[model samples]
Target: MIATAREVKDRVIAALNDHDTEVVMQYFARDAVYVGPVGPAEGREQIAWYFEHLLQAFPDLQITPWCKVPACDPAVSAVSEYVMTGTHLGPLLLPGGSMLEATGQRIAVRGAGLCTIENGLIVSDRDYYDQLELFSQLGLCLPEAVA
Candidate 1:
């Protein structure tokens, strides 16, 4: 059976919040493109590396999807609203090129995402969140918003 874009994205989001890199990667194609605050990760390996770093930074990362908006022909594209909660316990490079050391701060932030699916596989994913809010929650200083 073929899966819908929403289904694919739902599973992907769940896997992401679980911090299971392999499960999260299954939703994307080998050559998939992922764009987030940090930058673009082109290819599965890069995506895996990104998530590995992310999980390392936030071992308790959790994402809650508030909504899913579907559009485009065949409904292969979707916009999802989400809220995230995590604790900073490891070094992480912010989107703005700043490195943050372990602050052991807990943070919760709201965000949105966009993704395009093809043949039930994620072709592209774009994530948008407020980096400033994250920094503030972490008690860290940032010159600007990371995303």
Candidate 2:
């Protein structure tokens, strides 16, 4: 039996909550593209690396999906709103090529993700979240701009 997009998304979410990168990778196509706040990760290897880094940064990370939009085509798409809670216990690579060392701060950031699946595997995933919210939670503030 073919797996629907919702099924694949559920499995992926379960794997993520378990902090099992291997299981998560299983649901992504070899050439899957995962686009997040930082950037796009093309291919399974890069995607796996992205997940690994996230788990490392937040070893106790937990994702709670509060809402899921019914996919018009269950076989091809899935979307959901979730809150990710975790402590910054490891280094985080910032967008401007900076590394943020662990501040031991706990954060609960609300976000959403959309995935496109094909043949039981995710081909593309786009994640949206407020980077400023996350940074502020970690005690980071942007420097003032000079006129």
Candidate 3:
């Protein structure tokens, strides 16, 4: 069971490196939830849309897996640590329907993901990453700079 979870976790990391819409959608359940920097996205279709936009924003995105571990229930839980490297080459849309212009900056940021699997598909996957760090790498600054 744990072995299956580990393979799923590894495949997920590999799929994230590509731009294919189907690749990103295959691991998710129909009603899966994906939590990321912006917020939680409910449903597999929503999660697929998120990845599509993300790949557009970072056309050369690559994820390097650092670690993967079985967390609980073997086939039900796994955690992954990785570094996502990419260049901002297209508009990045925000949750509230606003878009950040491409800054053409490159970022290699550390991130982690916790995934819950049911019957070999992801039911819930929460990703933890430094959004502020990503913005900083892209040279984004608020109107009022903080010291």
Candidate 4:
């Protein structure tokens, strides 16, 4: 049986919950791109690197789906928010050529995600989240929020 968009979303969430890079990579297309508040990451290599860094920063990450709607064929668009709270036991690169160690602080960030799947693999994702909140949680530079 072929995998549906919902199935892919579930699997991806499960993979993230497990902190398994291999599993997460399974759902993404080789050329998939991730665009989010943090920044833009293109291709599987960069995507994998980003996830790896995230896993290192928030090893115990869990994603809960707020809602999901299937889009044009083979595409499942989802609007969901996830909370990631973990210790910052690793080095985090900040703006202005600065790095900060994890303060073991807990952070919860709400996000909006749109996942596009093709041939059962995620082709692209557009993520809407707050980078300011993330930075503040990490004790990094805090930029003014958009009014």
Q: Could you tell me every candidate's TM-score relative to the true structure?
A: 0.90, 0.97, 0.90, 0.82
lDDT of 3 by residue, 12-96 (tens): 7778775666876888889999999899889977998888889999999998888877897667788889899999999998647
lDDT of 1 by residue, 55-76 (tens): 8989999999988788564368
Candidate 4 Cα errors over 4 Å, as ranges: 69-75, 95-97, 141-147
Error of 1 at 48 (Å): 0.8
Q: Best candidate, TM-score-wise?
A: 2
Candidate 3: regions farther than 4 A off: 1-3, 145-147
- Expressed as tens digits, the lDDT of each residue in 26-144 for candidate 4 is 89999999886667899889988888887776666666666555555534554455655566667665546466676777777777777877788888877776778877787766556
What CA root-mean-square deviation does each model show from the true structure? 3.3, 0.9, 2.2, 3.3
TM-score, cand. 2 = 0.97
lDDT, model 4: 0.74
In model 2, the Cα lDDT at residue 23 comes to: 97
Find the number of clashing residue pairs for candidate 2: 0
lDDT of 3: 0.84
Per-residue alpha-carbon lDDT of candidate 2 for residues 1-147, written as tens digits (9 for 90 to 100): 879887888899899999999999999999999999999999999999999999999999988989988578878998989999999999999998889999999999999999999888999999888899999999999999999
Output the worst ten-in-a-row residue range by lDDT, candidate 1: 68-77
TM-score of 4: 0.82
Q: Please provide the root mean square deviation of candidate 4 (C-alpha atoms, Å).
A: 3.3
Backbone clash numbers for all candidates listed = 0, 0, 0, 1
The deviation in Å at residue 19 for candidate 1 is 1.7
